[model samples]
Target: MTSVVTSETRFVRSGDVDIAYQVVGQGERDIVVGIGWVSHLELLWELPETVHFLRRLQSCGRLILHDARGTGLSDRPARPATIDDLAEDLVAVLDAVGSERAVILGWVDKAAGAIALAARHPERVEALVLGEALATTVARDDHPEGLDPAVIENLAAAVEQGSWGTGALLPAIAPSVAHDPRVAAWWRRWERMSATPNMAAGMLRTLLDLDVRALLPAVTAPTLVLHRSENMLVPSAAVRRLAHDLPDGRLVELPGADLAAFFGDTDALLDEVEEFLTGTRTGADAGRAVLTMLVTDVVGSTALAAELGDHRWNELLDFHHREVRAALARHGGSEIDTAGDGFLAVFALPSRALACAREARERLAAGGLTIRAGLHSAEVVHLGAGVRGLGVHVAARVAASAGPGEIRATGTVADLVAGARAEFEELGEATLSGVPGLCRLTRLVDARGDA
Candidate 1:
């Protein structure tokens, strides 16, 4: 069967309501796909970037796409729709298409329905992929910080007003879009075609009130949780919690913060998803390893900022940021986070981390920037975004102890580096404040030597 064009609208009978859908690709493998709220299949195809991502997925297998009720071409049934109803729509669509079982790919708000379906009817779902998912609308009661109610209210109002196109919504959805004229225009057009302000607001509220923490363990199918390390929409901790709660779920952290799947590095996302679904990649066996952690910071950044003034300082800081980022990329170090004038990064190998730190310090010194770096190796929690553990903390502390243009390493790291044929001097065992017990540190090179 030839795939339906985006503009071609069709409907599946779901009891009393007709749910609108579009079929794409003609592969034998069937996949039922659900997009987040406010999707216009036709409009989506008009955007080359969005269509490219969809077409690529279609090339691998058939894609069954649908608009959830109350948005797009689907019948806007009344208020207070639950994920259960949304899941029912999915089942109805499958029944209409005569698909016995298929992989389910759901993004953003639809993640709740995807989870609910996988939990309720494991027989119908072969595998599952949820991107930018949320476990609960209200953070766990144990969560120390929940989203501010005022902020949520304002966001809702903005969506309600249909001001998402002009206001912060555009810039917020894809921050990097502002830098690219073509992409920015496409985003604005896509948003306009997708949903009205009220519809968007309603869906936003639906997502906010949703909490699927209780349904996680019931999910039996192989599941992949795709999230960006820097996602501003959903908290990283929440995604971590989802992985922890799901019985067969694995996490893959993509690099960019663009919440829209089609916006950034979609090829990587597709590869990971396909690999997980097929037997080629086992999420359990891959990505788990002990690695060296590194933290680096500009020396006297506040003082320098004051000296250079805000604009000039920001300009210089931008240059510094680019330099450090390029150095990290060249050395195979994954940047974890950027805080003011500092960075947190990780390398899978201790030697790489050590070498990268030395290179970074040397490179920055030439740029009129002074840097200190610390490295440690321990059983690091590889969250795909960055490494975390006591080892990471120790590395940060050691970096703090180092003077400008110096590199330091914890005793654990030093031990790993002992036979690596690198020159180093012991800094002696010292009581690291807040860290338990004494830590032996080594200075990779004396500060004066670099001078």
Candidate 2:
């Protein structure tokens, strides 16, 4: 339903509490979303990534998002909610929306309640999709792969000690976007609006205490378990066991470490979900995507060519190209184009792009050829073999502004990779030729560690 707005929140009563929910789009089937920890019904639409994720799910079916009891706009009970209470609240929201059966899309720690519901009332859940989900958070003798109880306890203690509204949890949830100033600001407000410090801490403890391993066999619906290949938050053994125990479950590990389903490679994650539900994959258009553009130019190319003569210069330039290409391949980059004594590439992540730039610089220097590079992150339009957008121009201009052997990045790129091995020194504002206004540029002083 294009007319459906995310801001128009509605309420559904489950027992004495009022659960807040919003509906968007219409399709043959319904998809209900349940996130781990806390979430704000309206705040979920603030970020572009989150909006895109919700829309992608909507593309395949009618989407339902609700705030569980004790969090967000829902009534915060004095006591914490249990798995049974959460299941009832979910059912209440489904009934309010007139959904007979819907695909339960649960994320991270919230999957326990969804699993319990699926087992208890299989008729209400058509299918299940769990992303970065854990059957249990605490380690048991039978499930030793689960998280240490002490670690979760320490985290809950920190949450109780005034760490709720400061955006401290963003890194563990979505490290890719946590360092971004805009994202950090939005997250701080999200945390404050979702729950108070005590409420969040209590929820953490309750979620950790939940164990749904015994319910796996009773969940008769087809299940898809999606996990990130490099996710550091959840142990791989726990996820593997989750898939193994489910009667009809299949595991697919995608590429990324962000535990938050809306961040990282959301399009890839959605592809799997859509295919599982619809039996076919109608993927998002690749015409435009948020990518990091990297541009590199050799220093004094014309003069050096004249000094070394055409034959020798050609050999060195050829070696430089080979070295740069090698670096790109090593750092997970796609070479978009190459101009005279210059190269252009793009990376899905800003950290990888930064590392590629650094590696290329060092490789070229070793070969007696020095280069300057620039990186910028933005939405670029892909046409034919190359990309076209103001972002590409900004990257080229930034590269032109860099000195020999220097790697420069726009503020957008720098902000995205703040916690990575890279470090930047602000170069203030520069008039990027042909682009509008002044752009803040940061010099990549060091990007030497593993990204």
Candidate 3:
């Protein structure tokens, strides 16, 4: 049995405030993790399960853990909290540790910050593991089963009022252990170790309002996204969407309803995280071939560009890029590459890639830029940079065959999409170019009723 590694707390000064961190294990490779908002490093160490999880990870390499500002042992700075500031705090902790680069593991809202740090300083991030991560929250406006604006406002108001003790925010935020006694106790303890209600409210507000969906493709490190299938606060679909959008990301769906990392069977989570970090379980390139592929393009972008002229068209294209990229990130569609006015994306799950394409087309329609998308599932070649194989070519052909503002998918894609909450209109069979045989086509339609 591996013994508990002795951990020592250390402080690093960043500007006017001091950031606290703990070091565990000892190895050539270092892993610096940025804990989620409202964490107490000392308190977390006391939990047997949490300790076990950390120890398991520590066995692989040295671990550098730190608390975010305004929470736990870290000195709270008067500056307004942003994801950048949180990342800087981690950087300060790393600088003090005398390490140049380290693997980063970020949970919950820290996902965005982790990606930001990785994007800004790729050299400092050897690898990245994001738990329940997202590039942004801009999709909240069009979330399939998201909370109503009024409900969200009321919950935010209650969090602002009662802060940690408020029952309203706890259920939605930590649905995994909303009813479990032990889990609830642990949550309460951790909440108390951090800031008061107002500060908690501020953190919650930042989480809800901040949107960084466009940055998914900018991340430079190999990333692993662990999303719970039953997460209630952030819909499982939303997390699925995130997996599809990241340039170098893979999604592993764990079975659990609890959002908190320590609430569920942490061993399984640690196993996945460890395998990804250490490259013990066949690196990111060795995943199976059954995945969804989505290809999208503007219907008449050349004509639109010619009519609008270079100046206005450039501005419009920028807006289009921002909107489309945001949608891909929100829906978890990794932007493989962009054509003149098209995007090629691959997904580990067929349903998510299809859903993301549907959502993108629907949302972009308002901006007068109609998009056609096509999806298919089959064996794919994972080359790290982009996916290859006949399935990708078939999906591309399906996209070319689609009409303006329509989503056309091959028979395989349609079959996988059939049971999803979204509805589609079957367009019957069509012989796709270079494909072996005739393929059935389907067009995605608004499915609010089915949802």
Candidate 4:
């Protein structure tokens, strides 16, 4: 079992104000967490969900949590918050912690600050992760999902009227758990202690007119955007625009409405982040759940090795590697390993894995090689290298049982993608080696027949 990381609360001087920051774990890499508004360095540990999130982030690297100026234990700045102030504060915190370069993770409207920092100081940031980020707070001519002008004005007025705190905001931010009295009280207290009502109002007014869309193109770091499917605070459409506007950005729409990442379906959200940051999924929380697995085997490897000399065979293998990697990229699959001439990979959705398998088979055939692939969607343990459990064994057996130039999958995958641009032919139940009972297998057929 991995030990829990201990975080130390400290303060760093940025400009005229002191910024409160915390550093957890001792991993070589650095991941700076700048959730921006409403934070208290000591009080944040009171919430179990947030504590879990920080610990998980520490598992990836040395997690750096900070309360930006005008919020939490940090000193209030002299003037209203601007993009440059937030960016400069971020740099100061990084310098204080001795982090030369780090991955920046930001949430909601505050994410723009991190985005701006990455755009302006590319040398200080390695990558970026934005959750439910908003480029603009008010509705623009192109983005209709942003908050209405009337609503934004009303929000500024309400904050000025001392109507700021989780008691008034938790329902809108995390409706899934807003009804729970205990949850509400905890968040309310945290929000109240974060900042004075007047300070909160000034911050809200500053953000109302802020827009960072122009900085999207200037950001050179790789980025990932995670948005909730039914999020009300930040519309899913806005999240889509953020992903599209930013260069080298990938969007993942998780299932939930909670603007707070520590709410519903938090594990799925964190698992994706961990994998993206560390190139491995240390799935400590997501146990044996529904997962998609893809197994591929190059047909007639012995014959090919004999036909082509040793050096030429190795070259052909390299070509095969390129072909499969390209296919995986097109289909959103992660290559697990290349065991001999066979490849093992996984995907968040079964359709993608099946598409990659069929595409790879066709592309390999063009290069005078035949491949047999199998896919299965089942409960499996996700480790760093590849998945474990009986499901993986069954998938490997299914691939070996497949005929040359064929793509096979389990019935579960067929059921999952029934309405997609694909179908499956049931091949009856077959007893797989090193498995319990007989499992039903199916061959994938794209809309255009015999994929």
lDDT of each model, Cα atoms only?
A: 0.76, 0.86, 0.74, 0.81
> Least lDDT summed over 10 consecutive residues: which range in candidate 2?
1-10
How far residue 109's Cα lies from its native spot in candidate 2, in Å, is 2.6
By TM-score, the better pick of 3 and 4 is 4
Candidate ordering by lDDT (highest first) = 2, 4, 1, 3
Native-to-model Cα distance after best TM-score fit, residue 167 in candidate 4, in Å: 0.8
Per-residue lDDT of model 2, residues 220-328, tens digit only: 9999999897887787788888998999998999888898898888889988998898877664553478899999999999999999998999899889889999999
Candidate 4 worst ten-residue window by lDDT: 442-451
lDDT of 4 by residue, 1-451 (tens): 2444456789998977888998877786899988755678787677666666676777788878899888888897655678888899999999999999999998875688889899999999999999988777677887665655665567667766766774777777789898989788898888788888777777767767779988988998999999988876677787788888898899998889887877777778988998898787775554445778899988999988999989999988988999999998988888878887889888888878877888899899999889999888888754434566677887798899999988898888888888777877899999988878888989865555322
Model 4 CA deviation exceeding 4 Å by range: 142-145, 286-451
Off by over 4 Å in 1: 1-7, 142-149, 279-451
Cα lDDT for residue 413, candidate 4: 84
**Per-residue lDDT of 316 in model 1:** 80
Candidate 3 at residue 72, lDDT?
Answer: 79
- Candidate 3 Cα RMSD after full superposition onto the native fold (Å): 23.6
Encode model 1's per-residue lDDT on 204-260: one tens digit a residue: 777667778778888999889998887676777777778767899899988988777
Model 1, TM vs. native: 0.59
Global fold similarity of model 3 (TM-score): 0.57
- Which candidate gets the maximum TM-score versus the true structure? 2
Better of 1 and 3 by TM-score: 1
Residue 387, candidate 2: Cα error in Å is 14
lDDT per residue, candidate 3, 86-148, as tens digits? 677778888998889988888877777788788777888888888877656535554443223
